[model samples]
Structures are given as structure tokens and as C-alpha cells.
Target: MSAGMAGREAPLSRWTLLAFAFPAAPISAMGLPLVVHLPPFYAGSLGLGLTVVGAIFMLARFWDVITDPVLGVVSDRFETRWGRRRHWIVLSVPIMMLSVYMIFMPQGPVTAGYLVFWLFVLYVGWTLLTISHISWGAELTPDYHDRSRVQGARELLLIIGMVCVLALPAVIELANPENLAAARVASMGWFVLILLPISVAVAVWKVPERKAPRPEHVPFGQAVKVLIENRPLRFVLLADLISGVSGGIVASLFLFLAEDVLRLGKFSSALLLCYFISGVMFIPLVLWISRRFGKHRTAAGSALFNAITVPLILLIPAGHPELALGAFLLFGVNMAAGPFLFRSIMADVADHDSVQTKQTRTGLFFAMLTSTNKVGAAVAIGLSYMMLDVVGFVPGGENSAAALDGLRAVYVWPATIISAAVALILWRFPLDEAQQKANREILDRRMLDAAAAAVETRTLHPGDAQSSGAPAD
Candidate 1:
């Protein structure tokens, strides 16, 4: 019934989707491996205590929770020639590169003071870039399936990035121990130098920007009130947080299991590379299933699959490297499905919010999502560290039986948390196929009404109008 819905065309090309998706690959690839591997690296290599390492990780993530929302609000309010979201993407790439370089290649001694400061800066910069990039993707299309396609492309690219990061560290060490450290530095630098420019170019050249409507003099307090009052948004945020924490717990502990339990040694990097590559391999399969079954059902099935598969990872006894590799491969398959569906659901939630409020608040929606993910990351990293401390995890040492037992506990207990999260997702995620269709229709109507209003305003104020102008004006 709505004007915007009367006739809407699908996206013209895959390039349009790639424009939004490609940039995310480098960012996700960089962030996921760093979060998974860096804590252990700092604890063992830098000789920081578990609690101290945990504290630093948690502090930086908590800082992201606060700043993410601000960034989202700022992006939503932003109006620019390069376009609202693209400009942020351009600005964030170099900063992200510099921050990552700093974190991995610390200049001074590995003192607590130095570690904390660099970690804080790196985490904040990464969060800013990610929040902006994600928001930009959400705003690219209002169509449901198109949004999924966009996300799938982005996620696929992200997996490629992860594989690169995950594999390179070990490859460097194995090939030449004499220059292992130099190789590590060069690998990161090369990816940053090469991928950063490519990502920005794709985003600028390929993705079309939407002209977001300016808010009609609404107060900041009112915007907050609307965000808080929206039940669907609230549910989506809570579920994402719960799921994020569960995933984060697994990620934070994965390296420890490979190194300490499986005794994989330098091969740990290869195993991780395989895990990421396996996830990437499953993207097409997940996307296919999602198309057939719908996003929520597909996600629920993946969560259930993960609930069963991830716990089996605990069954791999010490001295069985092949079994561990098999487990990671299986885990990666299930993990791949969840993200594809999860990101699709997130875009749907964004559409629902736009319909309800008559505003394109992609940045705010993604900001909230990112904030919860940070909270989840905080809980996972903080608690894993605390648990390590409790279980007598000794960094950079031959594992005593007690330390090994602690490592096993970290591996096993998080299963319970993950199981509960899957349950919440199955029961509480209220946005289903029919609901999404209805919401899309509503959004189409709103966009039509807004467009009509602009036309009427142009007619009334003819002197101020230009026949062909950019969307932002």
C-alpha cells in the first residue's frame, strides 16, 4: 500500500554488494585473530599476569561499549560529499592500520603501563572503524534479501582476511626462525598496505550511498527514549550480546587449548588457519540453507549444531593433534553458519527500526549491536582470565597437571554458557520471516511518504530547489 513499496528495483550488480562487503573483510580478519591470539601472546610472550591481561582486554572493550554508541549517533547525523558512511570508512582505514601495527609491534619494554596504554588506543581505534563500516553496510539497502547478499559477501571476505592473519604468524616462524619476528611485522604491514587501499577503493567506487533524512528537531533525550522503548530492538540487542559473549569465550580460549592441551606448538597457527578457512568454505552452504529455510531458522539450526559440535571439542584428549584439527574443522563449519545468519538478522532488525521510527538510524542500530558484542567480549576475556588465574594457568611454562586441568575447565565450562545462549536464541528471537516481510512493507511506505513530502516542499519553495541534486541536500 505504501508508495515506496509500489515498485522497488533490486540491486543492479554484485559490485554494489561488494562495495559494502569488501571493507569489512579486512577489519574482521584483523580483529578476530587479534582478539583470539593477542591475550595469550601478551600473557606468555610479554610475561603479563593473567588477571592483568584480562583486565586490559576487558577495559578496552568496555571503553568501546561507551564510544560505539557515540560513533553511531555521529555517523547517523553526518552529511558529506564522499557520502555519510564512506568518508568514515576512508578515515578509519589508516588509523586502524596504525593502531594494529602499534599493538603487535610495541616500541618499548612490555611493562604493564605501556601495554595498557597501547591496548586502549588500539581497541578504541578498531572499534571506531568497525562500528562505522558495519553501519555503512546496514544502510546500503532496505531490501531483505539484498541485505543478506551484502552481508554474505562481506562475511566471505572477512573469512579470507582471517585466514591470512591466522596462518601468517606460524608460517613466518616455521620458514625462518632467525627472522620470525621481522616476518611477523612484515606480514601485518603488507596486509595493511595492500588490503587497506583495495578495501577503500571498492567501498568508494562500488557502493551507492543512501541519502538519510535529517531528524526533525528531535532531542537527544528523545532519541535515547525511542531506542530504549523499542521492544524488538531491545530483544535483538540482548540476544546478540548473549550470543557474542558465548562466542567470545570460545575464541579467547581456543589458542590456549591448541597450545597447552593439544600441544600443537608452532603448528597452532596452521590449525587456526584451517579453522578460518573451513569457516570460509561453508559460507555458500550456509547461504544456501538460509535461502531455503529463512534466516532465523537457519541461525537456530546452526546454533543447535554448534551446541552439539563445540562441546565435542572437549572430548579430544591430550596428544591427539589430528582429532583436535578435525574438531576445529567441524567447529568452523558451524561457526560459519551462525555469522551468516546472524548478520542477516541484524540487517532485518535495522529495517524494522527504520520502519518504526521513520528514521534511518543504521549507525545507532549497529552501534548498539557493536556495544553488546564488546560487552560479550569483555565478559569472555575477563572471566576466562579470572578462571585461568583460579585454575593455576601458568603462562610460558611447561604445563603442570594442575594448569592443564585448569585449561580443561576453561574448555568445558564455557559449553554450558553456549548452550544457554542457543536456547535463548531459539526461544526469544521474535523476528521471523513473516514479521520481516511486514516490516519491509512498512519501511517502503515510510520512504515513499518521505519522498512525497520532499516533492511537495520543493513545489512550495521553488526558488530554493535544484532539478538535479545529490541526495544529501
Candidate 2:
């Protein structure tokens, strides 16, 4: 076993980590398949207007953002024999499943108001559950490589889940010719009901939480202040926000490009399924490259590559649709490297916090990170919708060449935004492999010294110091 694995040999089993990762895949997969696609489905199939659909998505996302950090903070403070994080996982899975059911299973003649209410509840509950789960995984292992391994596994599972969700809607349609919408609704409902509980159970049962040292009774205000004062963490959060927005913009606009620019009809979802499948295949290759070049360099190179490719995708004429599809494959390659790198960086931030405060606040760190990501996602989706409206792009209608051109422009924008994110990573984000290793060594030494001091204090009483030290019973 390695030095980092010395004390962790017993608790950190492969099955334990796999259980933690299983739920992440399904939950993340739902983002593109449900959140992004469901809005357009509501507008086109259910006869709700685009304005109302957009409003519902925006409102629900806003609620999700607020709930993320609050739940993180609450989970951070929670103390239980079952562990700080597992109880949340156990309780939230059912609520999360119910929310999915409610969102997909609409009543007779769905109205804008009803959609908005259900979406808000569903999104808010999902955010709370997911943020807690992510934080738990972050706290699972303290070793640098171990952290990467854990997150890599989680991201890989997430990709698998995404591919499954993307392919399911199409697969269901093939089996049931009539009632396509009902098939979609039934498939999502079944996925949630069956997968959610099993994933949650695996994580809760297999992954044993390490005993966190009891935190000193600091006031809540002081804890918040300390978190704000942590300079490295603040920088990581900012960089992550910028990168997340760039990624979110690309995701939010994928459907519009497929339907309007590629002209793929209902097969648009299948094309997206292919794109995501490509990403899943490439994730391990990207992780290997990160091991050689370092996560920062790898992420920067991939982002720059994506930026250049996005504009090139726009240049592809309608004559050759294959060129555009090829660009999407490259886009997937770029995306595969990012989440693994970003989540690993977050683990580093958590390590730095634990060293400084002597308090394990992984839940708070992840919660804040999730909150920022939600903000980025909201901004990206809102901006894309506004841009579409400005370009006079009509939903579910034949478009002019200019409208197709506008859709191409939307595809190009995310590449430019991601390129800027690359620049930010190059400048900020200071810690390298050597720096982290040194930091960990120093922390270990400090902990040992503190333990020795406590022993000395216990040995020496107030009055009989030197004499008692000779033979203390």
C-alpha cells in the first residue's frame, strides 16, 4: 500500500467508492435529457408557449441555486452515527425520485402555472440532494491521487448515466410506435424509481465514512468569515465559475443546433446520444493525458482546442453535414477532460481548507462550488434563450437561411467563452504537484507535533510538575 493508503486500507474499498459514484451518473445524466429537453418538449408537444417554458426553467433554476449552499452548510454541521453525509443520501433519494415522477407525469391539459410549480419543487429538491452527495465524495479520501481516482470514477459513471438517458428516449420510441411522449415519460419515471434507490443504497451501505474530528465550537459567523478568508479556495471557486459557464452555454444550446442547423428532426436526440457516447469513450484517455501533463495544462489545452473547433464547426456548409458532426465529436473529447480535472482541483481546495482551519468542511466547500455552478448554468441558459429570441428564431417552425445562420452563431459563442476560461486557468490556479506534496508533508508534521504537545500537557499537572513527571500514577 502507498503512504496515503496506510490508515485508509480498510475503509476505502473499491465497492464503497463505486456505490458513491453510481448515483452521480444517473443524476447528472438527467440534466441534459430532462432539464434541457423537457422545456422544448413542453413548448412543442404540450402546446405551452416558449415564453412560459423558459420562465419555468429560469424560476426553478433560481430556487435550485439558493438551496444548494444552504443544504451544504446544513450537512456540514450534521453529526450522526450513520455518518454526516449518508443520512442525507438515504432520505433525499425518495424525495428526488418523487420529484422526477411529478416532473414527467403531468396531469390533463397542463398549464404554464402548473408546470412552473412542479419544476420549482423538483429542481430545488434535486439540487439539495446532489450537492450533499458530491460533498460526501469529496470528503471520502484525503490523498491527492486517491481524490482524482474517486472523482474520475464518479465522472465516468456520470457519463455512462448520461449516455443511457440519451439513448433510452429513442430506444423506447422504437418499441412503442404510437405514444412517443408517453414512452419518454414512462422511461424517465421507471429510471428514477428503480435506479435512484439502488444507487443510494449502494453508496450508503458500502462507503464507510471516516471519523471526522469533532470541530471546535466556533460561532457560525466565524466559520463563514474563515471560509471567506481562505484565499486559495476563493480563487478556485472563481475559476470554476468561469469554466462552468462556458460548458453550460454549450449544453443549453446543443438541442437548438441539432434541430435547426443539423435539421435532424426527432433524430436530433439520437445524434446527441452519439455525441455523449463519444465523450464517455474519451474520458479515460483524457485522464491518462492529465497524469502526464498535469490537470491544469491538460484542461487548458482541451479548452483552447474546443474554442478553435467551435468556429470551424460554424464554417461547415449545409452541403456536408458530416463536418459538423465531426466537430461535435471533437467537442465531446474536450468535454471529457474537463469535469474530471475540475473535480480534482476542488479536492485540493478542500485539503487546503482542512489544513488551515483544522476543521473538515468539505460539505461547505462543495456546496459553495455547486452554488456557483448553478449561477453559471442559469446565466448561460437565460442568455441563450434571449439570443434566440433576438435572432427571431421561431420554435418548431421552418426557418429562413438567416435563422439557420443565427443558430450557427450560437454554436460559435460557447467556444469563444471557453477560450477565455482557458486564459483564466493559465494565469490563476497556482498549486502544482510539488506544491501540494510539500503542503501535505507540512500538515502531517504539524498534526504529529500537536499530538505530542497534548500528551505532554496531560503528563504534567499544575503543582507537582517535575516530581510527578518522574513517577505519575
Candidate 3:
């Protein structure tokens, strides 16, 4: 039977998947605040303006252009008794924890310099952990459909993390309602601090990284050539970039849209809770749809659904949190569809690359994928914030109607159009189950051949055959 068919015959147990996916919860908790809460907190509570915060975030992300691929290459080559990917995860925990503390709970007088320095450290750690973790997942199973289950489980935990973390700020918003920004950041810091180490330990200790073919060390130029020739990787990266941009813009502006434009400041966190809860609810359905159809088709349909429905956000009446919640719920139903599906597709691409090149470059491919996501996020946050600034849209302050209109425009149109483009780009993605299955079979044969050759060489030295007749002893 084919690799995918074999995988269907013996899928990973739920406990194994859970042990592997647990770390996603804490990582995503940190991420949710960075996109939804940190920008506003820094801009409004800490007295740094939007433009400065956006520029700093953008610059920090650009730093990843260097770190991500470099770490990817290094990790791919790295091996230890523990494993290639797990050590990096352990190494990242301290760096990430320290940076999280500094950024989320600054001691005194925060400045642009403080933000810049800590953000740089944070991204390095983030890239290390994220690329290693994902590369590990991609290497776990070669089966096309099983890859989706792995990624789906991770994304599910991610949304759950977002929901759980948002609950803290939501409750704080309701109870105290004073120094809310400070409280939000502080609570998030504590949540992440307590959870990140525990989650990392559990996953690294309980789950073992699967062994793969040791990759030949290709020169940089040839490696670049291989990456360029990868058509499926290109398509997945483009689709991911567009989706990331859409998500980044909406995430960066969600609180702003909730508080300033929709006049539901107190309900902002609650609305986010509703949105993420919707995603958590819908992930299983999306995964099932991908199983029924193809991953690419399901992802495209989801993107199209978002594109069609996002513009309706403009119609939400001012100060109507209930109406806004309904709109957010509508928009969020397909939110879980694109990310995990594209990641699973990329895993298949890595398999194809391995077959053609005879090199395991899963880490590098996932790094490129991660880099595009960061680039999209950087551009979205940088440009969107600058645009908001140009329109004189102030945060946590009264705004003119023109400013509100500008906010609404910036929030709605870019995401709507870009999400549509994602649909088009991924509609006919070249890689599919049959292709990946073929690649897997090829790899399996190659492995068997190599093993047989090794055994034959060990069993019969060059002199053995010649001496066989004479050395009858």
C-alpha cells in the first residue's frame, strides 16, 4: 500500500499527538498578545506613538530574514543524543522567557530603544523555537493526510491558547477597568511565564523526534537553486504570505477596531474570545473537509469565504457589541482553515524535495515558510499603522468621524482583497496526495537500497570472496 494509505491504516494515537502539540498553547498565548494587545498597550499606556511602535516591530521582523534560514540550516545539520530539533527548543526557552518578561513587564520608563532591543532578542528565540518545532512536525510523518492531523492539532491548541489568555484581560477589563493596558500586559506576561517552560518540557520529554535520512550538506548556491525550482513551495509560500498579511492586519487592528471604530472598547477582548472560540470550534470541520476534498481546495474555499464576508464588518453598527460579536463569529468560522492546511501542504512539498534532491531539507523549507509569514506580518503592521497615523487616528482617544472612516477602511479592504488572492493562488496547487504518495514510495525504496548495500558491504569484504575457497576453515 501507499504511504498515505499505510498511515490511514495506523494513524498516530491521540496521546502521542497531544504530547507533541502541547507546546503550541503557550507559544500562541505569547503571540496573541503581541498582535492584539501589545501594540496598543505600548502605544497608549507606555506613551510611545503608533508609528514608532510599528516601525520597531517591522525592523525586528526584518531581522528574522537573517536568523530564520540560518537557524534552519544549522538545525537541519545539528544532531544530538536528544535529537536535532528538541535541543533547539530547549535552548530557546530561556531566551524567550527573558524577553517575554522584559517586553511584557518593563520595569520603568520604556523607550523605543528598549522595545527595539528586546524585540530583536524575542524574534531570535521565536524563530528558533518555531522553525524547530514545525520542522520536527513535518518530519514526524510522511503521509499526506496524517500531516494535516498533526498541524490541525497544533492550530487547535493555538486558538485555545488565544482564547484562554484573552479571558484574563477580558475579566480584568470587566472588574477593574483601570490601568487596563498595564493590567493586560502584566497578566499576559505571567500567563506565558508560567506556561512556556512547562509546555516545552512536556513536549520535548514526552515526544520523540522521528529519524529521517541524514541530509547531504549542499552548498548555499545549489541549495538556493533547489529552493527556487520548487514550484509547490512557491505557491504555498505566496498563499501563506497573503494569508499572514490578512491575519496580521486584522490582528493588529482588532482592538483598535473594537474600541475606537466600533465603540466597543470594553467588549474588545470578549469579541476576540468569541472569534478564537469560533476557530477552535471550526477546526475539526475544516480538517474533515480537507480529508473529503483536497487540502488546497478546502483552504481556497475558506479564503474565498473570508473574502466574501470580511467587507460586512463595515456594516456593524457603532456601539453594538452583540452585532459586532456576530460579525466576528461569521468571519472566524473559516479562520482555522488556511494556516494548518497550508502547513500540511508544505510538508508534502518537503517530501517531494527530499525525493528529487536526496537531501532532507524540511527545516529549510519550513524556515522559508516561517519567514514569509513574518514578512507579511511586518509589512501589514508597519504599513497599516503608518496609514492609521496619516489619517490622524489616535488610539484610546476621541477621534473625528473622518478618522473613524479611515480606520474602518484600513481594517476592511486590504484583508478582503488579499484573502481573495490567497484563494486564487492556492486553488490549483500542484502537489496532491497521489504525488506525495509517489514521492514517499521512492524514498522508501531508496532507504531499502541503501540498507542492503550497507549490509552487503559489511558481510563481504573485498578479500573475502578470493579467500573463500582457500580459507575453508
lDDT values for all models:
0.73, 0.71, 0.86
Across 166-258, the per-residue lDDT of candidate 1 in tens digits comes to: 667866776776646445655764676578768878778876677556656557687678778877677667767877778778788877887
* Prediction RMSDs, each to the true structure: 2.9, 4.6, 3.7
| The candidate that achieves the highest lDDT relative to the unseen native structure | 3
The list of candidate 1 runs beyond 4 A from truth reads 1-7, 179-186, 464-473
Candidate 3 per-residue lDDT over residues 1-473, each given as its tens digit: 33233334467778878888888988899988888888888887888989999998888878998899899988888899988899999999999999999999987779999999998999899899989999898877777888999999899888888888999976677678577778888888899889989989999989998867677676878877878998998899988887778888988998888888888966877888998899989888998999999899999999999889999988998989889989989878988888888788988998888877888878888898989998899999999999999999988788999999999999899999998898898897998878887888888777667766755765667466446543311
lDDT of 3: 0.86
Question: Could you arrange the candidates by lDDT from highest to lowest?
Answer: 3, 1, 2
Tens-digit per-residue lDDT, 1-473, candidate 2: 23333223344566767878998866875666554577667877788866666666766677766787788778888879988888887878767777777777676678887887777777766776777788777777656666667787888788788778777788887797486876786676667678878888887887778655655567778777888887767766776676667766677777777767776667667667777778878877877877787767776777677767777766666535567667667777766676677777777777677666777677777877777776667666667777777788887588888987886787577658767676566446676666666666655565556656656765766345455664432
TM-score of each: 0.91, 0.88, 0.94
Model 3, TM vs. native: 0.94
Per TM-score, the best of the predicted structures is: 3
| Local error of candidate 1 at residue 29 (angstroms) | 3.3
